[model samples]
Target: MQFLSAYAAALIVFGILDAVWLSIMGRLLYRPTLGSLMLDNLRWAPALVFYFLFPVGVVHFAVLPAFAAGSLQTALVNGGFLGLLAYATYDLTNYATLRVWTLTLTLVDVVYGAAATAIVAGGAYGALRVLASAGWI
Candidate 1:
């Protein structure tokens, strides 16, 4: 039950933050740079897969460890590092292989990923703590 609560909190936080980021950046950033490569419509299946699975990664890698250590700082730092690695994997690979992938985009995305993941992990950890205190989780 505790694990599920943590996972759920992480998923919700990550999903909300990522959705807002994507919606805002889709025009200001991605469209200007990667518009040519952009699909007319989103492919939801892969996106859903990523959204669902990434939070599990966060719960396992960041939230649980932070809980074990009883430190929110652990969540933020580990989550940020995980985000850096994960986003760098995608952005760097694209920058390496795709002619359209700009260095600016890669750098911005990697930074965003790190910051966003840190926020998500911290938010989830905080939420779990509050819920536990309230005897809700």
Candidate 2:
């Protein structure tokens, strides 16, 4: 139950942060290099589903341990590591298989994913602590 709360909080916080980042930077970062292969319109349903599911793994493997350790640093480091692994898995696989995939995009995404996850995990931990203090969780 506690984990579920943490996950939900993390998802909400991270989703908002990610949405802002994408809205501001996605086109500048991706459209030029991959325009030919880019879909005319994004399939938002699956993309949103991916956002929902990916955080489950992030919260489970990274945030939970950090909470146990009682350290924000742990959350940041572990979350970044896990995020790198996850993004690398997706980006590398696409890079290997898709002719349109660019190394620049892959590298940029891996870095962004790591940083974003670290920030989100740390923020989630802080939010959970605040909630617990307020007797909300």
Candidate 3:
């Protein structure tokens, strides 16, 4: 039903976008394992948690299925703002010190966060518009 499609859409968008970002990260600075990955990724996690949680994920997957219909908006305003803020902070911090490790991690966070927000929001909005036009709203 609607629940399946909504979850499908969100997962598809997030997965593809995160994959691309992770690819870029791996190419540039290599990948971290275990705890280090978590530490490096923290800068972006707050916004991402919101992006996936209590969002279109909630509205589309839960509310829509319950009503046998619904609308979907990715709510990107906050996501974009947070991504930008975190990127700027990381950039400034990295610039001042520019330690190889720190710079690498911050760069990864900045790029990944921005790209993730743009791709996820853009993908979701496009899908929502398509669904809306198809009367899947």
Best by TM-score: 1
TM-score of 2: 0.91
Query: Model 3: per-residue lDDT, tens digit, 47-136?
Result: 667546633643343334333333222235434544556566767675676534465566667766765654554455556556767998
lDDT of every model, 2 decimals = 0.91, 0.85, 0.54
Cα TM-score per model: 0.96, 0.91, 0.50
Report the lDDT tens digits of candidate 1 across residue range 1-137.
66788888888888889889989999999999997899989999999999989988888999889988989999999999999999999999999999989999999999999999998889888988888899997
* Regions more than 4 Å wrong, model 3: 1-8, 32-77, 85-100
Per-residue alpha-carbon lDDT of model 2 for 7-118, expressed as tens digits? 8878987899899988877789888778878788889999989989988877887778888888889889988998899889999999999898889989998998889988
Pairs of residues clashing in candidate 3: none
Off by over 4 Å in 2: none
Write the number of the candidate with greater lDDT, choosing between 1 and 3. 1
Report the error of model 3 at residue 1, Å: 9.9
Scored by lDDT, model 1 comes in at: 0.91
Better of 1 and 2 by TM-score: 1
* Residue pairs in clash, model 1: none
